[model samples]
Target chain A: MDSLTDKIRTLCTGLLKDGKVDMIVGFKKGTIPMSSCPCVARTPEQAKELIWDSNCTLNLANYLTNRKEKIGVVAKGCDSRNIVNHIIENKVTRENLYIIGVPCDGMVDKRKIRALFNDDITLFSEENNKLFVETASEKKELDKQDFLKNNCTTCIHRNPVIYDELAADPVEEQKIENRFADVIKIENMSSDDKWNYFNDLIKDCIRCYACRNACPLCYCPTCFVDESNPQWVGKGQDINDVRTFHLLRAYHCAGRCTDCGACEEACPMDIHVRAFTRKLVKDSCEIFDWEPGLDPNKRPALDTFNPDDPDGFIK
Target chain B: MKVIKIDKQNWTGGIDKSRENYQIFGPVKDKEHFVFKKLNLKEYPDMENALSVLSPKSILFPQSEKILAASLDESQDDHHIMKRVATDYSPRAVIGIMPCDAKAVQLVKLNFDTDDYRDPYWCDAYEATTFVGLAVNKPSIYDFTLSMGSGPFAEEGLDVLLVDCKDHFLAKVLSEKGDAFLKASGFTSEADADKSAKLINEIKNQAEKAIDAEKVKTEKLKEKSLLELHGASFWEDLSFSCINCGTCTFVCPTCWCFDIQDETKGKKAVRFRNWDSCMSPLFTLHASSHNPRAEKVQRVRQRFMHKLKYFVDKYDQGTMCVGCGRCVVHCPVNIDIREICNTMNSYEAEQA
Candidate 1:
């Protein structure tokens, strides 16, 4: 059987050669270990640069927003869902995209792997379910499942919701118990405790806006924080300003987020940014019974208004 | 120069004792990663910390600072007039700061302490702080400090350099501030000067050897014309992965760009200087709604050009990077500055 990388390259090369897509969006080998940066491949030769691995953590759907060219995008389960959301939002047209869906084995958290050693991780590679980490002094072999990203641990969508082609057989989605345990723990706190908990969570945020930029849904021409005329949020490190930015950003993606984990992966501070969005995800699920991006034909929970919608908090 | 031997057992006590006259800051474990924090009496600096997520630049230049303030009231004297905010310029010591970060401070000084204009806030804060650098015995694979003209044992900007020797630290005083700090800590046990110097050199050689394996050409960057490099075709592909986030700039010790903003709340007004990144869309936006670098590629190009070309040409001091590898390690999309530097250095413009 051809590896996923080989299959994707072969498919993308055929697409580019046939002039099916003007470009192919995918992952390329990164400069350092446990990283695969996004790349744009316009030719057959460039398409060969595309690789599929556990380190392909970023959402490739982000590159598809408002693009003019016909694009063949390599998408994981999360990326495909985001593409559906993009189509629904009219950020991209369904006709312009050829999504090569990947049945993903969860991405490994680089931080977790890094924590296992005192020295730097010089090289990281995976085989089967095992990960090999090498440093100057020693080499360690560990289970990939043990180092999976937090979002990947509870992910129920291992197969893409929508795809033009499948790179491999669909992965078995794990049956997760108490998926919102962390959120429930926070919800059980008193209002003051919750306030303090959130404050402590974002204490290290430098207001770099990596979280906002990494998000596929945050394709606004001008972010609310950037508005100067009656500026919504102050451009300082003030606690209130920082809190406001996070709160408003989470609210913007309330019902539209697909739990892609791109924001947390992009953060340099290693802050648990998902702590803000996860609550909203739970609320959207519990109240509206809405899960975004499962179907391109369906409107977002926030976009459509129903007569029987919950209005208990209106007063 | 003086060399003092500080026993490992006395480290905490000496650090505590120095707090009487100095506000000490050092690297401490902050949740998952390490960060420089203001230390209380009980806390000790983690001298062996592998890396700090953010550099010690925030010590002298905070992420946000109030420079001026005023009253908007009509009846009061000195109303509607902005006055420089009073700042605490007391003595402080930054212990266990990496040599690259210390060099970064000096690189930033070129902008803050120029011949024509002097930024009082930066210069004042810089003067108040004492930099005590910790020599890197084991350089990370990402660290390319030696290629950028600063090394594991570089002492360009530090007042003192501390070498870890298992049982004790060998402190080599490089400036008067270091000597004063040692005296204040009551650490007067002088090591054999010649022996200590030889030991430090041995450690430095080993560390530099590990760093010397990596290559990043910057000497030829001087020969290349700015326009030729700026118009290079590689930037488009090079910048494709960039998300235009401020992670690289924010974590960088040498990046010193700032935006001045005024906020008015009720009858009180304040002017703040906040750290800004060229990667931001608004960084170059004009008041007339015109944007010079509107595209993401342009913003990405500007960051590299400024760091690798513009600053190098203007100062003739080298690239604006100290090669601390913070950007390399922290960039979400893995945009490596080392690769960019090499590309810019060796780039040749096609004939027109």
Candidate 2:
């Protein structure tokens, strides 16, 4: 797995030196422990700073939106999927992208790891399947498999659907047994319980739009929250307004979301914001027999109407 | 000024008693993080933790609040007119607030409260509450409060400052509001003022010394000019990783920008204000669609300049930041403000 880092830098520097792409977008060492930051390298020298690790949780597809310069981006399974979504949606030109793909294992959940260390993980290092953590007083090693983020644990794709270059050999896709169990739980609840469940889920929202900004699908020039002619949602701290914003934002990505966990990772509040988007993913899977971002030629479930589809709900 | 001591067991009793007269806002453990909640009767504040995910600023300047409301009913004479919303401005107490967060509220008050104009909602909320702060005895690596003029034990904005002595809390009452709050809670046992002062100074010195060891100083920032610092070439590299999300501003104790809008539900209209961030492109967008800060760099530059330069020039007090390190810890990309502050502070004017 460490060999992938060398391959990434080699590919990035080659592109930059040969003028194959204007910039190489990848991950760099983060100032915070157990995290990696997104980086864009214009010079070959800067490409050496790039790192490849499980901590590269942010989707590189987020950086590809409407970009003018030809870019070489490092993508995992989820990121490559989102790139396909972007190309199909006409958000970006596929010709301009040089996708360097990585077969992913999973990303760590910082919250879960922190709890394991009693919330004092200040220093960290990773080995084969063990994570070494330290506090001011002591150090400990724990199994990394126990701390994978919820989205990554259920990921069906471990290899990129589309890519210009492969940094390493592809890994096998997972057989997720309970992918829709959470959404189904909420679906079975009574109307009042479901309403209360979702309301409490988003009770801590500060309306910072981290969830929206982190998503590759949310590329609108003017979001509904900023519309003035007929403001769809109020900007105040009202719980109703907060709930309205989340529900509407989730619906906008009904068939398009890749379930990449970028929104959940970017959220400072640690909200399970995917609780709303995953339901859409389940609907697309069960009703339309569709998986988004797998094939660009196929339209999303919501984008086109089928004559054979049930017509009673259309009206 | 007076000093009092309250037993650890009686902390809940104090809060339980205070609920008789004052509404209580305090930090409570919420799943993986802590949040400031309006506690129900007999509920005790979560004093076990030193900091919360969101600061206590929402007590005075909530993320969302109603300022005015209107009705469309034809029978009323004031129909079609907006009227001030009925709000409870009665005495309230926010316990378990950090001293840095309290100082941030005071810094934000300079914007909401002024000689020429006043924000009625914030001002009213400010006047109606008593701030009870908890001093940080052991500071984190991210804490630079000592370098920013507000130490872990600074009492500039707090009415009653509590120093945890493990078994009991040494309460230092600094203002009349502190006296009223203490009285309501039935905390009548007074401690020796001189003894309490000596103990507080010991913790204060140790925490400040720890911060000084980090050496993330800000004294040089005051000497730099806005134009020279703004033109520095490092800003592009510094802001490169930024996703332009509102995580930094929303978690900050001092950031106070807001956007106001009206919402109508069944002919009843409400005017409310929600938190806004300068990091967003929409923050500076004009009605003509001509945005001056259209680029992400401009927006990023505005946040640091406002905290480091604009606020310093406008207030003549200090930088708007209290250095609580919420933004430093919670930034998705690990864009530390301490590094940016150092860059701006030490930036030399280019040779002409």
Candidate 3:
């Protein structure tokens, strides 16, 4: 890991100095102990600040789109797949991007990791493949594998599938269980119960549109709901509007969602938005044997119509 | 043609007298904002003050209309199908249409008339309606000067063009529909040659000046390639402040994306279309659970690119965005489209 970090620093410094990139967006040491935040490095000196560790869990590829200058960004296994998807969608030009692919041995859920320590853990240090957390009291040592995020448990990709530079020895891929137990649990409920459950969950929505904003796939110029000439959705708070919003969102993401959990993370109401998304993902896999952000060459399922595709809902 | 004068105060009386004969619709105050609604001549006496918050397109393409309805039956050893019903379009008058909206109705007409799957519902409604376009002596708060080409009024498709000439409105019949409507009212007369010339000159001058201003600005913005602007630092800066509430698209006059779904009961189903926004993560979500655009910045970029690039490429005309500034006023974070255009202009200048 030390050798990998050094190589990354050298590559980033050269890229910045040679004017190959305007900025290097990567994980940097956070002010809080043991955390890493996304940092933009414009100069070679700033490149030294960049770091990669178990704490660097953010999907940094989200920032690469809509940038003017050539940019170098760090990508983990899942994050690299997202970049591939972006390239396929023409959201980011592959030629202009400098992707540093890093093999991740799963990231730790910070909230869960923090719960193991005192509330006032002001600082943290990583050395010799061990995490030393400093709270108000004495320091505590913990193994890196104990606090892996839930998404990592079933993550099939551990090596960067696409990259200009490799940071670490590529890790072998793991087999993942395709069963969406959570969605199936909800699906097992009676139709009336499911309706009530969805209604109760969606009724709390203030329509802030945070989930939409945080998501990476929604890229339309004139959203249908916003059209005024033939007004689609009314401008007021109605149950129909709320239902339409959620149902439409789910339908839109039917095949494209990457399961980054960013929407759920960004949601203020703590609604289990992922439950519906996971259901869609599971259904897509079951019906089409397709997973998004995995293969960039594959055409989107909805955009490509198939006569053989099941249409039980359609008349 | 002789010009006739009616006291501004008595215009309402004229409308009231005509109310018994025509189904009059115009802008009416709805709580805080104004919307086009059915006007009772006694209630909505003045039509010259404010612009209608809602476009008059609803008269042609209603908010919700049944495109198709079907029923399934198994007892007869065959599936039974039922056809959707059409709407009745009796004679009606849509009063106080701004120029942009008038143009929009015409644009929609082109699509309905030429498309393979023609919208019979709107076509029938448009054939039966008479448009009374009022000149915009005052600019709307939601004006899209650059995209709209003309400021408020474009004198092309209106049946009757009403100019606010202080004491009396100077009315000109542009089409046969206007002629028939005026004759039926018995209150309108042909304008004198001098008055007609003056009104034409005024409208031409206003439209030309607005178009000229837009030409200069749009040309400057067009100098930069939208593809190059994709990765600009300015997008990050412009988008970081955006709350992604989607109010900007909702308030836009030209935005027209929709999603269709079916609601079913007892083997019967009604398919309905609802508005969908690109700002939401699900807009491009394929059934395979892969979204190519997975970030807010990409979504934001797509919005501007469609307005400035894709729309122009698809529609030979500028997608008819008569710069109604509804997006500016309605956006929760005040992410103004004008600012985005200006930013694009400046960014191009900087690059150059």
Per residue, candidate 1 scores C-alpha lDDT tens digits across A1-315 of 128889999999999999999999999989998898999999999999999888999988888886789999999999999999999999999899998999987998999988888888888888898999998888999999999999999888879999999999999998999989989999999999999999999999999999999999999999999997666778999999999999999999999888999999999999899999999999999999998889999888988899999999999
lDDT tens readout by residue for model 3, A122-234: 66666655777776566788776676766676677778888988887898777766547767888899999999888877754545565665566655544555444455765
Runs in model 2 lying further than 4 Å from the true structure: A305-315, B212-215, B265-267, B349-352
lDDT of each: 0.91, 0.86, 0.67
Clashes per model (N, Cα, C within 3 A): 0, 1, 36
Candidate 3, which segments miss by more than 4 Å at Cα? A1-315, B1-10, B13-22, B40-46, B49-53, B72-82, B108-115, B140-147, B199-216, B220-226, B229-233, B345-352
Tell me the tens digit of each residue's lDDT in model 3 across B1-352.
Answer: 3333445666776677666667777777654345676776476624653643345666666444556677675764434564665555777777777767777676656566765777666678788888887777655334555355644556556887777777777776778887676666665645576966687668656644434344224445445665666667777645654546555554455555555655566987666654456776567776676778767678888887777656555666654455655555444333567667656656642454
Candidate 1: TM of chain A? Answer: 0.98
**Candidate 2: lDDT of B33?**
86
Q: TM-score of every model?
A: 0.98, 0.95, 0.52
DockQ for every model, please: 0.88, 0.63, 0.07
lDDT of 2 at B32: 78
lDDT minimum window of 10 residues, candidate 3 chain B: B208-217
Best by DockQ: 1
